[model samples]
Target chain A: MRQSTFNNKFLPYILLLPTMFILVVFLFYPAIETFRLSFFKVHPWTGATRFAGFYNFIKIFSNPEYLHSFVLSAMFAFAVIGLGLFFSLLIAILLNQKIAGIRFYRTFLIWPYALSPAIAGALFNFLFNPANGVLCYFTGYRSWLTDGRTAILVVIIAAVWKNLGYNVIFYLTALRNVPQAALESASIDGAGAIKRFFYITFAFLSPTSFFLFVMNTTYAYFATFGLIDVLTEGGPAGSTRILIYHLYKDFFVHSKTGYAAAESLVLFTLVVGITFLQFQTSEKKVHYQ
Target chain B: MKQVKMAVMMLIITVVLPFAVFANGGVDVDESATASIEFWHAMSGERIDLIQSFVDKFVAENPNIAVDVQYTGSYNDTLNKVKSAYKAGNAPDVFHSYEIGTLGLINSGIISPLDEMADKYKKDIPWNDFFTPVQSYYKYQGSHYSMPFNSSTPLVYYNKTFFEEAGLDPENPPKTYKGIREAALKLRAAGHETPVTWNLHSWYFEEMICLQDEPFVNSDNGRGSELPTKVAFNSAAGQKVLEWWVGMEKEGLFLDVGPGWANHRAAFGSGEAAIIMSSSSDVNRLTAALAEKGWEMGTGYIPRPEGAKGGVAIGGGSLWMTNNHSNEEELAALKLISFISEDESQIAWHKGTGYFPVRKTAMDQLKKEGWFEENPNYLTAFNQLLDSPESLNTAGGLLGIFPEARELIQSAIQEMYAGKPVKKALDEAAAKANASIEEWNDIMQ
Candidate 1:
């Protein structure tokens, strides 16, 4: 790796200043403030705070709905990551083939990447809505939104569908980078197609997979708030209430800042713990070439 | 910039100084009294134009007052904007909030009570001429805290065309819970899959409880000096409302469109549902929507349970004056809201949108113009309001934690739809609401 030398130390510091300022202001300051807020009881309108010493934490922890949301969010994140990556990789592989109008297919397949989650949710909502829905018309008007389990599935499907284009884009790039020489040699050496893919291509894709795993986890945890909000609004008996959605209702809708801060802390810790676990276990298997 | 600041300072002194002196001594407001103030509102779409039209008229008439009107998003979004703006010390001189937000805003201490402002400015608002229900809803601690602009109640909107097709009388819409069910059965037998739906909202729940003349909260429906410690939504009245609601869903007679305002309207507009309980303000939109489908829409008071004697509570937004503005700006905002609520503006607003005219005089004006006879659907909303007996329950509940409680009740309804027993669901919702109420009280302390 070539390293560039800076002519002036002050110049290097000045170059770093803007990003550092943003980090402190947008990220670090809020994190510290949230941590502090988690321990207090906050008046919603007046913005007054009183030190409550674990009251807010205890309140959320003891609530079954909050616990349900926490578990639901974790499961939802994993489901999104697993299904999003699988379908996208499959589609990416197919699109990589030299077919007629491949460029057109690729462009169309990746178009959903440009859409925000709320739009995706709205589309899915219209298609599957029980009353006069286009997809509901085909499904004999089965009500998908009113049932708890199915509503969660609907949200998951919407989230996965919204995210597929992004995943496919990255996977397509990774598939293209797979060395043609190694694949040809493996084929010449009598390796079957499946064996070649597993032994060679899959190994190279691990690094990309690891990168996607982290990104998708973050996306599932955070990015799906808008999708869930628009589609279900954490309803059907709060079955679709993911942690971020619950946090939003608490902080924004209900105006319970202290409780929301405590909830956010839990969510933050859960995401961090998952990412740390992933790095510890999955990072070891990544084959960086 | 320094010179500009100096000019602004001079302007404030020259303009505001005399206004303060005149405000203390003079009975008449100076037409030349100049003050620029921002008015943030939650009304979107064409209503923005309607609001601007009247405000423009007011601005033209009072040439010195520059009103910067902004269309902030929804009621929730507008309140959030005000919160941030207030913390930043640039809150709007006046902003709009919904009916349910009355208690929280009162407790929020960010508002200048309208009665106090009226007293300070020596401007007597036509309180006696204002509608009783509308005025009482905003009266906190025996004082008017906000100016009621748009007052609405939920009404049962039925498709007259669908009713006639179903062999039900188009003129005689269902007026009771049992009547509604029978009407639904007739409509469904006539090949309508779902005969009814309302947006999955606690507003209907709250209204139904009120229709029974039952208080939603124990402390005089949170109208007393004591803050509401718990909700009455788990009581028999509340459970009865849910049982009917969830029962219709179970029998596949009601379409559950979840929360928010759109889906239920969509269901009714497309003839997927023949009857819907929605805001009185939805009269114009839903009527137009059904007309697009060549269906005639009818309006009725939202059906009550058998022998229920209570009436509907108001369900729209009001304009609140913020505490931070200068007296000059305050006086200007007062004038602006007063003008908006007057007979002329209220009549225009009522005709343009289905929201009720807050003033009795406006109602009389609309009646004199023969507006209701031509648009009888409009009369149903007004008659429903006039017919309502004044009571603590009919006045509507006030609570510092109403927003959270509303969500709890909405989720409980969803839970009931998911096959949870009505009583259990209401009980759980009430429990959670009580807990939140407790927490809010503690925090406010």
Candidate 2:
């Protein structure tokens, strides 16, 4: 690989310039600003700033609502990732079989990936609306969103539903690329279908699963803000108030930019930590081929 | 190659031409030059059509001033858009802002006070002609920051059919919380599934506080000599309101239809709820929807607790002009504002939308035309405002974090509904709200 590298160093750096510029300008700049903002109190409209060392962090950490949101975010992430991975893998495996209209089923399974989180939230909200909702006809017209526990459950279900298609698509692609001969041999060696799946096919899908775990975690952590905003608005006594939604309320609704900035940094650190931990533990078990 | 070059040139022009036009348009604001100004608002559907009609009329009369009206989603979305646009130095010349955001906009120093321009057009648009509650709610430190546009207050809307079925007089709807409970019990005994319902909005809580003659925050509801240092919403009056609400919930007299007003509307329109508390602005739509079902609607003041002395404060939004505009553009914006607030436009606006006419002359005109004779429900809000005494409580609270405070109260209410003790939940919400106020005051300082 070293020998095959371009002999002209300027050409490589020039080739990488666009991507590096993008990363620095879009990612690093905002991240650094958020870090700097966390140490100060800033006004949202007037662009005024005042220094307050660790005040934002202390205020947020000591607040019961913020702490509760942190816990709720963890539960939401775990539920989404767990349910998303399990159901997608099951569906992908079922869809991988050589059946008639299997392609149609696969395409149908991928349709949800096309819907944005906000659209999904709105769609589910209509379905589960207490008054005159389709689901209310079955539930005896009970408003599900008014209760804190059920509201959180509805948000989790929506989030999981929104992310399921992406996970299924990846898992399907990985399953298609799995070595058929290894599975056949394992089956021929008197291993049952379940045993062969666990010993052979499951091993082959580990890498894809690992990648999906990280992607879904990120999705649940940050990308579900639109879903929560539309469906619940972090309501029913803050049951669906995930960390990102909390940050958004403080920044936009409350105009507490500095506090929101501190929250963003905390969320960034949490995501980074989760990613690092996933890489550390899961990479060792992932199979390349 | 020539074709590609042509396509590239076309693309560049397509993208850059608008910027160039805007850049040139920004300059040359002379007496004869047309001052093209953008007006952002949260009006939509039928209301947007009415606003467009008025804008067209304004442009017809004042051809030199091209007024463009743009609908900017909901009120909260509009606030967010304005804040970002102000930061980017591209805010609209005029925008419709909810009254709750008055303090924040004033503190930002981006709003150009309308008092001077209002005086300039005193002959045509008499400032005193506007409704007192509407006008006073937008004033800060003795200066009016915005023009009272789509002002409304909460009203108790009941189904006349349901009231009659429940052996209650439709002409005499319940006027107090205790009376409502009694009426709701009768409604339930008459076989109504949900006797009463209201959207879970904190606006009603604020109105309830006013109805009880209690300040929502200290410093005379933040209209005193100095800014408020603490929230006063966790008072005994607030607790009493919540306790009654929770008691209704416990007895199953009131159905918790969740957050949006649409739910309450649906429940009422479908005859599922016998009585509902909603904004007076909902009269037109609710009447139409109920008329389709052959159900007559009755509108009354938002029910208060027994013996409460105060009245409901005004709700809805106001129009504001931004500061970063040329003199001609600012004048043009003011002209448009005055035109919208004029009696003729106010009558049209009030008829088109259920919002009360903010001008006394408009109301008089409507009365003279016998419009209220047919649409008596529309007079309820106007009568409520007129009956309200000029007190600090009815003037409504003014806080930089009023929106946030409302959200906190909403959360606290939800918590109480979910079985948290009323006082504890309110105290927690008040503490958090006070902290937000302090933080906001610190930033302003």
DockQ, 0 to 1 scale, candidate 2:
0.50
lDDT of candidates 1 onward, in order: 0.89, 0.87
lDDT of 2 at A260: 92
Model 2 misplacement above 4 A: A1-25, B1-33, B117-125
Candidate 2, after superposition: displacement of residue B179 in Å?
1.0
Residue-level lDDT of model 1, residues A79-193, one tens digit each, is: 9999999999899999989989999999999998899988988898888776666877887755687778788899999899898999999999999999999999999999999
Query: For candidate 1, lDDT tens digit of each residue in B14-92?
Result: 9997877675573455646789999999999999999999999999888889999999999999999999898778999
* The candidate that achieves the highest DockQ relative to the unseen native structure: 1
State the DockQ of every prediction.
Answer: 0.64, 0.50
Give all candidate RMSDs, comma-separated: 7.2, 11.2
Q: Candidate 1 — which residues are off by over 4 angstroms?
A: A1-6, B1-33
Find the candidate with the highest lDDT and give its number: 1
lDDT tens per residue, model 2, B135-254? 777767787878889888999999999899889999999898899999999999999967888988999999989988899999989888888989999999999999999889878888
